[model samples]
Target: MMLSCKEATRLMSMQMDRELSMGERLQLALHLTACAGCRNFRKQIGFLRTVTRKFGDQIDDS
Candidate 1:
């Protein structure tokens, strides 16, 4: 089922933590496939996660 923008945005938080159930994950995945806005949001979150890890590594290397 195609999700509305608001629903997709709400899923953004759960998606980031990989906390959604399999069905919910599938729904969000399908929604994201056709929704560039949500896809970009997901990408942004992924970037944030990467940046966080880099910062953590820098601290560890210090």
Candidate 2:
């Protein structure tokens, strides 16, 4: 079954912290292929990760 946008997004975030099972990975990949919004969300998450790593303390918490 194809994943809903919400489920795909949840999986994308979870992927940042841990590895997904093969099934989850497949689901996420399929969802991203079909959903442009989710693809953008995934790209944004990746960009945020890069920025955070580069500017850890520079980004104010508050």
Candidate 3:
């Protein structure tokens, strides 16, 4: 069955966090490369991670 955007988004997050199984990760990777919207979503998720990691350090110090 085809995954919905929300399902794909959740799987993307899990993949980013290394929480997905190898099989699951492979599936998500395939889907992301094929789906432009999901690919953009993945990019946004990556950008968010970078921003959070950068700012999170300062937040912890305060």
Q: How close is every model to the real structure, measured as TM-score? A: 0.67, 0.84, 0.70
Lowest lDDT sum, 10 consecutive residues, model 1, at: 53-62
lDDT of 2 by residue, 2-52 (tens): 999999999999999999999999989988889999999999999999998
lDDT of 3 by residue, 1-62 (tens): 56677888999887776778887777777777679999999899899989988995677644
Candidate with best TM-score: 2
User: What lDDT does the true structure give each of the candidates?
Assistant: 0.82, 0.94, 0.82
If ranked by lDDT, best first, what sequence of candidates would result? 2, 1, 3
For candidate 2, the C-alpha RMSD (Å) to the true structure equals: 3.4
Q: Highest lDDT, which number?
A: 2
Which of the predicted structures, 1 or 3, would earn the higher TM-score when compared with the native? Answer: 3
Q: Evaluate residue 50 in candidate 3 and report its C-alpha lDDT on the 0 to 100 scale.
A: 92
lDDT (Cα, 0-100) at 2 in candidate 3: 62
Full-model lDDT, candidate 1: 0.82
Query: Clashing residue pairs in candidate 3, if any?
Result: none
